[model samples]
Target: MTDGLEGARERRVRTGEGVELCVAELGDPAHPTVVLLHGYPDSKEVWAPVARRLRDRFHVVLYDVRGCGRSSAPKPLRGGFTLEKLTDDFLTVLDAVSPDAPVHLVGHDWGSVQGWEFVTVRRTEGRIASFTSMSGPSLDHFGHWIKKRLARPTPRRIAQLLGQGAKSWYVYALHTPVLPELAWKGPLGKSWPRILRKLEKVPAGAYPTPSLPTDAAHGAWLYRDNIRSRLRRPRDDCYAHAPVQLITPTEDAFLSEQLYDELELWAPQLTRHTLPAKHWVPRTRPDQLAVWISEFATASEPDAAGVPAQLAAPRTGRYAERFGGQLVLVTGAASGIGRATAFAFAEAGARIVVVDRDAEGAARTAEMARLVGAPDAWPETVDVGDGQAMEKLAARTAAEHGVVDVLVNNAGTGVTGDFMDTSVEDWQRTLDVNLWGVIHGCRTFGRQMAERGQGGHIVNTASAIAFQPTRALPAYATSKAAVLMLSECLRAELAGQGIGVSAICPGVVNTNITATTRFVGTDEEEEKRHQDRTTRLYGLRNYPPEKVADAVLRAVIRNEAVVPVTPEAHGARLLSRLSPRVVRALARVRPRV
Candidate 1:
């Protein structure tokens, strides 16, 4: 009786082995079926959050594997949890749920291990439509991986083998007789919730259901019955028949990413996703999991989904696996860097929220983004400098589209002239659009991301002028410098919450910002001339905004802190750190403008 699966419609199915499995179903039966399986020590409740999110579109089903949750444990409980018995139980459930249609299968940890068996075995062929696996690998695949490494053990292969062996310490522990059961049923079980909270960042109240002790106690046989036999005699013909989606958590302590490097050979139709969380992604990243599952499952079937093959295979662009099906919001997306960033994310299959003060331009960007590859695109009109407007936008975005996974605060107003020459109006406007816009964005959307508890990224567009301060551009430098400092401070603050903040210095890119730049202490005609001249100079520099956009996406993927996009920006950054006095001396030199 966990809080996670409260609303599910429950039933029981007796397997051929005389084991009764408890099943829960949600959503319309007419929709595409998505069946979720739980891992060791976990039951159907582990899929509750993900199930809830998918119910609207998918006929979502979850079931307690035999010997876990409310399901009756095997009479002997020794060899009952073997892969053979598990497959029998799965086929029984599938026949009962959707006898006519194949199901989209999703699994985590031990469940994923079982899924690898189900997808590869010839007996279960044509029963599964697709597989989404996380945190676990096929024992056969793992065995072959080890054998390959050991057959010709190089230094790198030996290191990898040893590293994975170290991570599998629990596997060895689980194979011990009686000790595992005793620990799981006693003090370890009692303290399991707290341990998960402290170590895995798993939220309390919903997981580690009341049957955890018994479940964990009985689940030890999963390793004892299978790990040794399968590894010693791995099957040669274990190729998958259905499309497979592998979701790897980069921070998973229990599993190494190296385990899946050869996954493509086994799964001919393979799509990969990289998550930034730890082991318990079901609890920590349910929303993202649900989105990816829905997208891939739909894309896996052209006829059942009515989506064209070309459109369905959306995760084909650079870094597509990381950004596909994610929600990305880009401010000032009407033109230049912001628009380019939105398009880059779009090409990688992310849903784009195009925002700018220019409503028509934002709409245009969103439209073009959809044509590129974005599953969905939205145009938003907002003045980011207005804190209230930003707050409202955040609330509305949450209400309508869900929380943003990535945020790009790329809006700015350029100001120029000496410190004394740049009037208060110029400073205020520049600060409003540049500094205050980023502040408001970070406050509003960043709060949503933090509250969601799932990881996210924020990219703030600063400039080379931020680090290499110039007398000719005092107000602009001050605002951008403030932005850089704020991004650094915010990154430090959000580091604990898995939210990354990046400040990008793009330098003098060939963008329209130069055309709109205001030259303080100049007549209207003089300002126009200066703007044209600066725009021409930047055109001669010829740095494309698309490259800056690529850097923004790369920074998010790498979780970088400070990124300098242009050559000039990188050199200025180098000078600022290595020799500040030299940079200061250069800052004093008057420009041609």
Candidate 2:
């Protein structure tokens, strides 16, 4: 057993076929039961991370499938691991654990394969309240998918069939005689942990267990007994009796996302969630998985009439397909571009986290985000320049709201003056908020994203002035230039990890930044006049902050390195690349004020 499940209560569940299964329970027995089933070649300990997360909220149950872990293998290994026998094992465990109440079923890989069976069969109808599947497909549904494509013979469908066939190479190998059994019990089982770490980026830990050799050898039978029979003659009435949540790992090596194209035909009330991770999400992305499972299971409860109603309504936002159920955090979200970006993500059904130095303003933005369509929204007050405070905020956000899927480092201040005239204090303050702020946000939150091994996006709000030289605003331009470079460097470093870094450059947007902009080397009266003049000029330009917000979303979707938001920003970028002399000439011109 893993350390996380140390205190779990143990029970022995005996199936009628003389198979003994090991079951473990955590949390209150009276609470709603959530049964977690492990995939092939994995013991119940594979769910230690997820089980620990869910134990506080619900009664969590985990059991090794027969022949996998502490469970006893059937007398004969040949036809022992069929789906019918697995179903019998499931019923026996369910009867022993929560005989009175139905359970919320959660599964990964082969476990998900079995879950599809349990949810669709008539005998297990009222015993299961909801089913959440990840990295697995029902053999029956897959059979139908293959039959339809072969019948149609479309080019696209044929290509999809070929692609999935290539991915299923291991399946064929697994069914080939005693060689698979020999490999698993020998060098293959010994090196499996290292393979997972290198390929899937699964952290090194006390998982896979010492029983892996025996487990894997026995598990090859799972494919041999079921794969051929089900795919040849799939059941027509294999429709789900309960609400189903399908969590697809976009980077899964074994399955194609296209396998579920016709899933809605089988499951009427299906909710889909896509994660940028690999196949073993139970260990790699347990935090996110726990959150999703909790939300889905809660919504499936009999008392959660409002939850299902809210989910049933289709989202109309353009980015809903990409961002729905994602968590987005925006700094300086009280007003201007930050606020607009928060609202835009909210409209796509993403959970919102509004961060700003202004507490009330952040709270207001969060409130508006919830009203707009966010499933959940929260406000966090912290100065991005304060490293310690940002660290605490990042920790709190992760612990409270889960890791941020999208981070927008938008908080910044404005400083305008010639290089010689700008005070040291002016430069320091400007760089602290504009450049160091981006650094702090990326360092704190980006680390969590990287550690989680799930892909995420980071957007740093630079300025058009970064590429387009400005004579008057020395301090602001320098700070923004640093931000642009930082974003570029970070992008290259994180590209391999699937974390995208985008620098958003916007030319003059009509916002409150100008009203508060500092004009150094000027008297109070002169500074006030300069502020007003700049603010008025920006207002006359009439560029909406919402456009910049839209660009932020587009940048994340495209994984763009640098985005020029407005017409002037685009022109300036083009000039910087194509005609440096013209850009220099434009920069030499004095401000109107």
Candidate 3:
């Protein structure tokens, strides 16, 4: 009880099964109750980080299951750790905490497994208002999944079965007779904290290891009692009785994402989330998890905070599940691709920070982002070309709105000219915004994301000219080429830190960038004419900025290093990779403009 939850009032509730469950309570009891549950090899201490964040708004509760932490293990632990018994323990805790009001249930790992049991079984129905699950699936659903796969056994299904089987080697290890107990009580126990830090990215000294060995040793019965039986004869009536939120860790080693392919069949009221983290999100990404859990729990209480009708509905955007509640910053969001990208993320329910050199335009974009479904949006006026301003913007963003989960380095100016015709001023201006802007963004905000220790994404907008060089636009091509290299280098550098860097090549989508484009060595009238002609040609192509925006989101979700958005952009990329001589020949041709 005293492990990590400071100021938490702890008590022991004795179950009918004669097991004493250790329960911790925080916040005002009259507020909406939110129960936090941990998993195998972990006690209620695992929920400490997330619980701290939720205590202000909700009555937070944490409890060690019968056999773990400070709780008394059941007598004859073999059969005592069954899901049926676990359900009884949960009910006992629920009755002791809040008898009249239903509580919001949250779980991780084995806790999620137990939560699935709690939310699905009829005995506990009407007691749980909502259930948020991560890193665990229902035994019934898993059983169904296995049955379906074995029934068909296609090549793909066979491979999936084998893959999941390998990932679950630890489960098989625990099922071995006395080996698990020996390992947990011995060297494995002492080394677990180190293993978690090295593999799961859980920071050192943050994870509580004092009671881990004992807790883990006792917790093995959880797998022993429930896994084989339930997985073999999973209940047919195991359908969720409450709204469910499922957060899937993309890089989880123990579970496969495909396991939840048919989860909607079991959880009718479901919201899905995909995190780029590994297994232990509770420790590594508590901030993001807390936000999501609060949002999901709050959504259940429609009249509690005067919730709007639109906010109450399920998100319908493409990556809504992944991006919802995340903080995103987009530079050059006043117009063109940046504006479209801001709107796209807004529709996915991300909190937007719309930034641009133009104050009024940035404000307008922020307002539009909120209108489109962003939980909140703010405008900042800053020239990306100025390194000092970008640094201030980065610091202010972190201080005011939290570290941006996604940063779009999208501000750039277009320059068109032959190498000889381009002046020193033109080259400097082109490099300042196109190359140095991206440099400042990555150096400043990327550091913040790294310092936060949670993962984030950085999107740098390049141009097709980066790939397919042209004689007509030497200065623009050089700046974009530099951007492409920077993105590649940063991607490699940040791969270790869970930060992704993507270079997006948008080709020539119809945007007002033409208005700001500079034509070197051209007379004023001729420059205007070229700009008009280029804008008209781009309009005729009718490739929308929205498509490029979609590509940006997709690239981040997939962690793609380089993305070419339009058809021409894709073509240029392919040519650059497959036929450099052809690209060079094409580059030799002069543009009519």
Best candidate according to TM-score: 2
Clashing pairs in 2: none
Model 3 lDDT per residue over 50-166, tens place: 888889999999999877888999988889898889899889998999997788999999999999999999889778889999999898899989999999899999998899999
Best by lDDT: 2
Worst 10 residues of 1 by lDDT: 305-314
Each model's Cα RMSD = 3.4, 2.6, 4.4
Give one digit per residue, the lDDT tens place, for model 1 in 1-593: 33587667888999987899998999898888999999988988888878888999989889998889989989899889899999999999999998978899999999999999999999998788899999999999999999999999999999999999999999999988899999988999999999988878777767889999999989899999999999988999999988898999989999999999878999988888888778988887776788789888887754745432332553679978788778899999999999999999999988899999999999999999999988789999999999999999999987666789999999988878888888888888999999999999999999988877677999999998888978898888988899999999999999999899999988879889988888888899999999999888889999899999999998998999999988888899999899999998998899888
Segments of candidate 1 deviating more than 4 angstroms: 302-316, 392-405, 417-426, 445-456, 470-472, 492-500, 519-537, 557-561, 567-593
Q: Which of 2 and 3 is ahead in lDDT?
A: 2
Model 2 lDDT vs. the true structure?
Answer: 0.90
lDDT value for model 1: 0.89
lDDT for each residue of candidate 2 in 206-232, tens digit (9 for 90 to 100):
787899999999989999999999999
Off by over 4 Å in 3: 1-20, 26-28, 75-80, 144-162, 302-313, 321-327, 375-383, 386-405, 414-429, 445-457, 467-475, 492-500, 514-543, 557-593
After TM-score superposition, the amount by which residue 192's alpha carbon in candidate 3 deviates from its true location, in angstroms, is 1.7
> How well does candidate 2 match the true structure in TM-score terms?
0.93
User: Any idea how many clashes model 1 has?
Assistant: 0
